[model samples]
Target: MRRIRRSIGEYINLYNGKRPHSSLADQTPDEAHFGTVRAINSGA
Candidate 1:
């Protein structure tokens, strides 16, 4: 049970703080949730 709980915690961390999602413009869920993304300006 402890191992399963630890695995679940790791998965949650990755899902929320590490893995980027296409629906979020490749931003991790934590970034999207916290509005911490920085915009890149390309010289046009």
Candidate 2:
């Protein structure tokens, strides 16, 4: 059970952090979200 949960968690992380989405202009979700935050914080 623990192994299955771990596998699912890893896949979720990979999907969000590594896989790019076409709707986001080919950026991974994390990159798309955090990049915008960084840009805003930098006042760029």
The top-ranked prediction according to lDDT is 2
Model 2, global lDDT: 0.98
Best by TM-score: 2
| Candidate 1 per-residue C-alpha lDDT over 1-44 given as tens digits, one digit per residue, 9 for 90 to 100 | 99999999999999999999999999999998777434333322
TM-score per candidate, in order?
Answer: 0.77, 0.88
For model 1, the stretches where C-alpha displacement exceeds 4 angstroms are 36-44
lDDT of 2 at 11: 98
Which residue pairs show collisions in model 2? Answer: none
How close to the true structure is residue 31 of candidate 1, measured as C-alpha lDDT? 90
Please give the CA lDDT of all the candidate structures.
Answer: 0.86, 0.98
Deviation in Å, model 1, residue 5 alpha carbon: 0.2
Model 2 TM-score? 0.88
RMSD of each: 5.6, 0.8
